[model samples]
Target: MEVIISNYPEELTFPQEYIDNVKAAAEKVGELYDVANGEVSVTLTNNEYIHTLNKQYRGIDRPTDVLSFALNESEEPEIEGEPEVDVLGDLVISVERAEEQAADFGHSVRREMAFLTVHGMLHLLGYDHMEEADRIEMEEEQRYVMEQLGISRDDAKEKKAPKAEPQQPEADKKAKHKSGFIAVIGRPNVGKSTLVNTLIGQKIAIMSDKPQTTRNRIMCVLTEPDAQIVFLDTPGIHKPKHKLGEYMVKAAEGTLKEVDAILFVVDATQKLGPGEMYILERLQATKRPVILVVNKIDLIEREKALPIIAHYTSKYSFAGVVPISAREKMNLDGLLDEVKSYLPEGPQYYPEDMITDQPERLIVAELVREKALHLTRDEIPHAIAVDVDEMTTRPNDDVYIRATIYVERDSQKGIIIGAKGSMLREIGALARTDIQNLLGSRVFLDLWVKVRKDWRDRDGILRNFGFGDER
Candidate 1:
């Protein structure tokens, strides 16, 4: 028997041992059925793509653990004369679903993959489980094959235990390093950016009391000696009142498809509301590993936090629950450990020295906007955007930057400029200090204020201000 495996999702990789296990399982099934010569193809894909395949082929609108398309059962032409080998139908397994189930079952993903492969092979070999009796028989066969491969449920659980002695080689230890992308997402002003900064030990994303502070997706990378966790700090998901609001929500939701895990940050002081519920439903649909992070634990008592944890646990089955104060940097190590367990074995996406992928100009613009958010009234922060028009360096001197702060109305513009331009000067001074620190040089700053009426509602102006359609 021959097994061919292909990975459709870049985040997932099938080790040679897994492939060999699948081949052995296929051959064992064939020997049991008196057909030793056979071949099977396995395609590993994510939930979104598998959802489409499920809808198209089985008329099911949701993703499942596995799908088997038996060629023998199809209406295609059958070859004449004696066939050289039996070509069993293809098997499509959702790697995302496999990871989730493995975590839930307290087993390694290799066990889950082998189980699904055996289940699909049974389907290909004319096994039907529509009836109770047939289902038992098929399950029995599955357990027997898995036991033969030394992959029983007990064996998988034993693999999770730590050995008393460290017998692994240095090369094998290095090869076990894991790396993947994680999305930190939540409702507006839930401390998403603060949590990201705390995790990475750097301030790459701007933070403010105002909602929608993050307008674009910012990627911050945390590289440890053994793992690299690329964190995508997304705009908070909220009800859209304008074009900018819509873009923010879309940006947060879009990260669900591409990330290895999601940190669903929430305000521990606030009660669970419809906004959280909306985000939870979306997370459930992705079938990805979601770690519920109740941020700002410093603001609430431990007794009160228990109820909040219970409330969320009752609502959704999160892979892990962590309580931390992003402002105070409390229990963040536990959060990182939870995140690291879900990431797959892979190479680093960015260099170890690099903390963020954001351009310097964009970071500077966001810094200016952060100052504006901090100083202005509640009504002004959401309606404001800063664009760095020019940034240049003089030889052995200082970094010069000119930026325009856009407001939605003339009144708002007046507030930003302030009496005798005091507000604009203050924003520029604070931003200049941060910019200087970032560039490690002296800085000269020029600031201007402009009004782009209803800019958030206008797509053309939004695009011009860097809120493009691409999420």
Candidate 2:
């Protein structure tokens, strides 16, 4: 295939390795379709450049990783006597979007670029993903092409995003870089973890309808062009019912003074209750600015959210009030704009590839716990705690994880294990799917149920579980 390259994003320095990977991917696609003699054009861009194209051509204002324009959409005879040209249409890849996605997926920019190139080439080859069958086929094709390139998800290493390091001066870089921390806090089940996951474009904090799902101070980072926001997903702030609850409340409250700003999220579906009032009172105690995030606005009428936003604004002098549906990703840009205003210009605190500070084992444990919370009964969820006993990689690059589910009672254990270990299998299956996504590898999850007998109230157990530092 004769691959033609267009101007790249000036801000990104494309390495020869990445360019070779892109070409290899396109050639692989062309060879499979017997289009080895055909011609194709590839254009590299950034989010700002692609946003205009997306808005103009596809009517989408947001930046996407890749956009394809297939030439064979229609056929028309030329008025002049001219020979037909063997050409596939344009393929535009946004470097910024690709970098963000690469970081989110725990892969290198080179691998992500190759994957996007393959995806766009398939589109030009008249393959689509508008339907389920087509999507599966396209995905299979993408997987095959990536495997041929030897940069599949499992093989991707931790590499920095493609950048213009030599071209850009230090003074310009200093002024452009912005990085800081922003703590997310609110009442239980207010979609704080969901908001963190949504903003980060991946799940670092586990989500559950049950209160106090996030028991730790999870640091989820969002890295954009010249900006990085560290989000501290704290445990929900509520009246303590047990030592665990006290630990959660303290962890949430302790973060107020240590961060750049606060995101005090509230559910739009419910009225201002005592729980919200408690959070509001706590916010008043903090000197840091708080951005009132009225989340879950999709559950009610758009107009109904106005009062909820107004009510919270009246309750306290929030730095900014952004009514957003974290689950639906509504008005999140406004939320980030408000957040970025609070962050000071500084050097990037974390590596571009690092999304969360939490280790693999902890994340795996949380994923398992999240699945248990979703699968079990209401009473069993609060009592359920997951501990990963062992985590090791097999010779074939697959992961082997043995974890135990600690519950307060033997009956709860029976409920989790189910008849003939059906429930255990179900939990492992569900958790394995998420763990696989999180790890980017096949996971073999082994689950066991154990009776810890009111571990939540016991400080020894709580300490063992990494929650004994409660004040």
**Model 2 ranges with Cα > 4 A deviation:** 1-175
lDDT tens per residue, model 2, 1-471: 888876566555665766777788888888877888877899887888988987776445577778888886365344577655568888998877877766555557887888889888988888876443575687788778777777766545644575543554656533345689898999899999999999998888999888889998898878887588989999999999998988888888888878999998888888899999988887777888889888888899877877777887888998888889898999999999899998887644543445777878989999999988888858576887888999998998888999999999889988899899998899899999989987777889988889999999999998888786843
lDDT of each: 0.82, 0.82
Find the candidate with the highest TM-score and give its number: 2
In terms of lDDT, model 1 sits at: 0.82
CA RMSD of each candidate after superposition? 16.8, 15.6
Q: What does candidate 1's lDDT look like per residue over 1-471, in tens digits?
A: 777788887666655665665667677777776767777788888889889997776445667778888885454456778666778879988866776555445466677777888888888987856443575688788878888777865346423222244666876543356889999999999999988888887668998998889999888889875788989999998888888889988988898998999999999999999999988878879878999999999998889999999999999999999999989999998998999999998644443446787878999999999999999958585888889999998896678899999998999998999999999999999988888877767889999999999999999999988787786
At residue 150, candidate 2 shows an lDDT of 72
- Candidate 1: list runs displaced more than 4 Å: 1-175
